[model samples]
Each structure stands twice: as structure tokens, then as C-alpha cells.
Target: MPDDSAPRPSEEAVEEAILTVASLPGAAKTVTPEDVARSVAAGPDWQSLLPSVRRGALRLAQAGRLVLYRKGKPVDPSDLRGVYRLGLPPEG
Candidate 1:
């Protein structure tokens, strides 16, 4: 469990961090949910933010702003399960 001092970013903030990290110039790989959580967390307690990060990523994927993958394949946003990575949709 995270101590009261653990970071608790807002939903929007978590989503933004996901996008920011995924869109970094030259980024050539998908980002794990833990990456997003770490980006917004202030310390080791970042693990505590995993739930919020996952929730934000799911919402973003459902909205078509992000893609969620499992086993190297994109999973239905409505039926995600197990470990996943976040990436942006291909640009035209």
C-alpha cells in the first residue's frame, strides 16, 4: 500500500502523462502502464498509481486516442486482459 505521501495524479493528468511519454520524439516502442505511472509519480510509490494509470490508458484506448496491446496484438478496448502496452495510432 502507498503511504499518504504517495502521488495521486488526477485521471486527466495520468492520461496526459501516457500520451507525453508515448509521443516522445524517436520513441520506437510501446510504453508499459508502469512507465506512465512512473512518469507522474514522485517516488518509488509510483507502483501505487498503477491502477489509475491503467484506468486512464483504457479510457484513452476506447476513445481511439491510444492503442492497447497484449502479446504484440492490439486488444479490443472493451475486452482488455493481462499485461498491456500503450502506443499511439498510426498517423496518416
Candidate 2:
């Protein structure tokens, strides 16, 4: 059984993960909790994120940082879904 006593992953981590995934073509389509977990596994200070951060990440994505998409449809920031797209090539 899972340890209920253990602290749950922070929303910030999840949101950051979401953004990271959003940056990627496959993950941007469907953001899920599991995908976020995979992001944590990759490498992040997951222990320090807060729920607000998660919410903030979503807000950022919606605003135009991460970029959201669905059903092969591109997310236009001005839409009701507040969906966006990571259009530009990632900078090194």
C-alpha cells in the first residue's frame, strides 16, 4: 500500500512538469499526473515545490509559456480554453 503519511508531490512540480511536457510535442497534447511524475524522475528539486506553484504553472501555460493543445487542434492563447503552444524553438 502507498504510504499516506508521505508528502504528496507539490503542484509546482506537477505544473513545471506540465510545462516541460508542453514544451514537448507528445506531452503538450495530454497533460497528466503520471507525465508530471516522469518529469520529476528526470531531474528537478521536486521537494521544494508548492501547490500555488502548480497553479501558477498552469496559469503561465495558459498565458503562453507552456502552450496547451488538444484533439490535433492548436491552442490559441485568446481562446476560451486559454490554450497556448510552445511555438518557438527552445533556446540553449
Candidate 3:
């Protein structure tokens, strides 16, 4: 069973998310906590996540695994807001 109380994400998970997102096209950019949350929530053994998970998730996105775009420039998760989506692999 997975521990639900743990808030911090292991570097491996961050790297995995980054690699998964990186497989898509475009320059790397910011990803939202909600996005990460949703991803984490999908695991069968996973329960709820803490707010701190956002930090690791953002790190993964900003680290170049995912392409982030905003205001005509690449931005960090902290600079993102409103509705956003990942643009890679041409999701239709």
C-alpha cells in the first residue's frame, strides 16, 4: 500500500512525469498543480495528495519535461493561471 501522508514527491516520480510530458512536442513549460493532482489521483493505490506535491510537479514541468507557454514567453508554474493544457504529440 502507498502512504497517503507523504507530501513530497521522489525525484524519480518528477523525472518520470517530465519524461512522459517531454515525449510531446514544443518547448518545455509550466504545468498546473491540478494537472499533477489529476495524474496522481489516477493510480489505483493512490489516495489524496497534499498541497506540497505541487512543488515537485512544477519542478518537473519547468525542468523541461513539459512545454509551457504564456504571454508570448515560456513561464513557470507560478506564472500560470486560468485554464491551460499541454501541447504536445498533437492531442486532437
Candidate 4:
């Protein structure tokens, strides 16, 4: 269980959570930003982690560790908006 009173996760932690959740859906399967955010969220305020989760996902996508999608098609991480999902690279 996470410490409800603890501060929001750091960039590194968010990154790790993104990868961890992405990996769980198996290769080429997707995980939503909310998935990553919930994994590291301190409590019921997981929604507050959205910005950090997006940033972490973008960083991972840039590093070729993950892919970003919108409407079932791949999109540039920097250009992502609204709802999106993350997945491991095809060969992952």
C-alpha cells in the first residue's frame, strides 16, 4: 500500500511506474496514463498525477522504450492531447 500522506511521485518513479504498467499488458498491448498514475498515486487523488504521467510517458516514448497512441493510431509524444495510451515497442 502507498503512503496516503506522502508527496506525489518523482519523475523517476513515474517513469518506472509507466514502464511497469506498460510491461504488464504484454508486448504491444497498452496501458493508459491513468494506469501509471494510479500505480504511484498516494491516494484517491490519482487524477492529480495526470501531468506527471504524461511527461513520463513522453520521456519513455522518446527513449524508444514505449509508444503513444490516440484513436488507435500512433502519435508523436510531444503532440499528444486528450486521451492516450502507452505500450511497449513492438519487439518488446
Best TM-score among the predictions, by candidate number: 1
Per-residue C-alpha lDDT of model 3 across residues 17-76, encoded as one tens digit per residue: 544544535534544434555555556433244344445445655665454555545556
Q: Tell me each candidate's RMSD, in Å, in order.
A: 1.7, 6.9, 6.7, 3.1
For residues 1-92, could you state the per-residue lDDT of candidate 4 as single tens digits?
54567776789999998988888745347878887888887577888889999988899899988899999989998798898998888882
Question: Ranking under TM-score, best-scoring first?
Answer: 1, 4, 2, 3
Q: Global lDDT for candidate 3?
A: 0.50
Q: Model 2: residues >4 Å from true position, as ranges?
A: 22-33, 41-57, 76-92
lDDT measured at residue 44 in model 1 versus the true structure, 0 to 100: 77
Report clash pairs, candidate 1: none
For all predicted structures, in order, the TM-scores are 0.90, 0.44, 0.37, 0.84
Model 1 per-residue lDDT at 3: 72
Ranking by lDDT: 1, 4, 3, 2
lDDT of candidate 1 over 1-92, digit per residue (tens): 55795447899999999999999988767989888888898767888889998899889998999999999999888889888999999898
Candidate 4 deviant stretches above 4 angstroms: 1-5, 25-28
Identify the candidate with maximal lDDT.
1
Residue 42 shift from truth in candidate 2, angstroms: 12
